[model samples]
Target chain A: MAQRPTKETKQSSAREERPPVVREKAPALAPQRGRPTLILVGADKGGVGKTTIARVLLDYLAANNVLTRAFDTETPRGTLYRFHPDQTSVVDLTSTSDQMKIIDTLATAQVRVSVVDVRAGGLEPALQALQDTGFLDAVAEGEVGFILFHVLGSSIASLDEIAEVAPYVDDADYFLVKNHVNDTTFFEWDPVTHRKYFEKVETAGEITIPKLNELSYEQVEIAGAPFSTFVANRTAEGGPADHSFVLRGYVRTWQNRIADEFDRIRLLDRIAGREGA
Target chain B: MSRRTLVFVACSPHPRSGVSTTARLLTDFYLSRLADVEGFDTDPHAPRYHELFPDRTQVIDIAAIRGQISLFDRLLVDDGVPKIVDVWQRSYDRFFKTVKEIGFVEEAHLRGVEPIVLFHVDPSETALASAQSLSASWRDLPMVVVQNEGAAPLGAYAHETLGHYPSTRRFVIGPLDGAVAKTLEQPDVSLSRLLVAPPPEMSIVIRAALKAWIAPIFTQFHSFELRRRLEGAQFLK
Candidate 1:
């Protein structure tokens, strides 16, 4: 268990530096307090509304009177920055490294609400490193981690993938986030078909996240910088005009439905312990 | 001798790029404060979100991830050193059950040396801890405790359980960015190595407004069955 001589040898030779390892939890503001709330927005495929959903949740927490922050494992182009400025968010231009630092910062302080957006395939590796580092155990000991999966029409294929990765999510509070609903017929999988798809994941011993829908053109534009700036404005352009017709008229209705359910999952209530709503 | 490879783990919906989006962000954030940080996106090969960002980050694609361990092993062997990794977890518990307890153990055995495990506490420990508690199987893994405040006891417990491992470490940060960090007087181990950095300036209001306006889009996709699907993600069909 002594420090390896090889590491010393390598350092001695080139003076090259490895990224500093973050094994212990970061220091906190104070000690005798509660842990922060950590929420993860994930989906196997791109365009499944992972970033969008995470943004909405963070916005809700901020608007609804909570100290909230957003983390994007995906870099430079943080979804929050598409709309808000740097001061408005801990938007890391570097993505994963920034995310780890922010998490370390938050874990040290134990911020109340922290929303995370994972890029399509990065979840496994990032989680692997965190586990190796032991921050996962630290976070587990302090906060509640919610896994949010955005599904549209319950693509059976996507669900099958979700099942394979389900074991990785075994310990967290899982929520299926149905996103970008252009129509509302409420999905119903044929029991037989559903069961068969699940078998694939089980047999493979891994989650096979089903395919998902990406945001529409209007959504993309809305999530883009120029338009996001308009939305971020304070006056007419900032107020309502900033948002696109699609986002204002349709997107809100769609996103609210899921948000309401989260409100219902009563995670906050559970955190507060029945004393508050 | 082969140095253990570095592996990053987390929940589903991984970014397409190879390097971690979160790790890239933190590195940029810190490096940016001092100087420019180059980023590269290697999705097709690494396929992780962090890899997809700017060219400043050296994004590894799927191909890179496929051989990430061996690659690191070779690099470390050539360097004559044990592999050092900066692991990032979006949440605590998810990490505890998977990487720290399971993967780390394996990596240690494979590399013939202790693999460095770094945990990022992104503003919450309750949910993370709850998840670990639910998974209870990895109760005995060495973990470096992270918290805002009053999280020392929890950290101490974890430390006592796994602190015996030579690879274990701990730290705390806050009281500046509207955060709190607490511990019982002094940790059982020497608190000399704790890494406390200045809190990043992040706003809650802007984030909230963003969510409210965007909620409908995400909310519209929910339903009783969808909830069931989410809960039963383990048994998806």
Candidate 2:
């Protein structure tokens, strides 16, 4: 399906009046020519900011002009859908019809990216479902761009879940995110313990989501807007906002840092393949 | 809706340029007017301002994430509470680097909180060069060259170098009496408080000397803050 950009009752945007948004990426970058890409953002444990990371990835891809669609596996009334309702569909990942809906559309959809906000405790089952469906095999043949964002908490089990999930993403882009956006600690694992499991994921490059100011993060949650829109001091519909300048500053800084991690990992190239980037 | 909240990052790239002393003075300046002020002493090794005003000040380590959140988060609040962060020469680059990278000045401006970098000028070539580098990087933000006359005579920094700043406002923090300076170095000493209730043991002569020493510097700072007020602030006053 050709997904149109969300056109909520548009208002005069603060971004339109201000100078152009600063681009740290290649300023004149073109759309990716890569194969249809599927990015799974998931964690075995809950509250690791997996969905939060997924939202940031979608925002980053949107900023780069990637035609991106999303599947919120939160079943009904997905939080992802709440923030990005127009581009997202809440689907049960285990259902056959839903699996086909996500997998079959990869090649046919106008969008280049398919981001799945895999629900809490649904990562392994989702991966196994894909494996059983022979989707990873197709991914290996270069028919699609497959990437896994394994958002890990600061627990040993979170690290152990890495080994369990590594087998499924062997042919895909694997990333272990040490999310500390709201957490006080990112990794409770000692250096040796971290390195042991870190060595297991063959192509995994570490991506860190830095801590955001508690107030700014909460404001975004309250506004129900994407981080980019929040930084622009606008609602999701692009209307001007009454957000505190200081809080917006904090969010802008936090957003740039998350983007920096994506840049460091060359996430665009990985999702688009070398030629597409 | 702001009352012109200002966050002054009083610092020097090189040590021994009397940054801590001046930062303490700004804190005292605000405190003297009974204005709400918080002092952040960034030198983890030794926090002089934190020692002097334990209740009003906090010691911060910008290297840690929590420290950054606590310091920067509070710095932006426009409660008519002026904030002063004293940069250790060691944490100087990291502190300002984070500020610039995070667009702290731009964000602060939007919230009606102006960030002023008070670069302490000394009688060294490094001080002059540091001033030049900062003037270039912080051109959009207001900056002031603070000449510590007690450390060295004024005009050590080249006049041409100083002229390059977009809004260069120089202030002197010295010509203070040597004896009074030694007394103010006490951990419990606060010049603002000293002007208030005179200590029982202190003679009237000594109190008068203290007032005389700080009068000119305080007046200079008062005008400096007055200049930074937004339009209509003067009319309201």
- Among all windows of 10 consecutive residues in model 1 chain B, the one with the lowest summed lDDT is B184-193
Write candidate 1's Cα lDDT for B20-137 as tens digits: 4233323333343343333223333433433323333343322322223222323223222322222222222333333332233443444443332333233234434443443354
Model 1 CAPRI quality? incorrect
Q: What are the TM-scores, per candidate, against the unseen true structure?
A: 0.38, 0.65
Best-matching candidate per TM-score: 2
- lDDT per prediction? 0.40, 0.78
Assess candidate 2 and give its TM-score to the true structure.
0.65
TM-score for predicted model 1 compared with the true structure: 0.38
**Reference contacts preserved by each model:** 0.00, 0.33
DockQ, 0 to 1 scale, candidate 1: 0.01
Residue A277 CA error for candidate 2 (Å)? 7.5
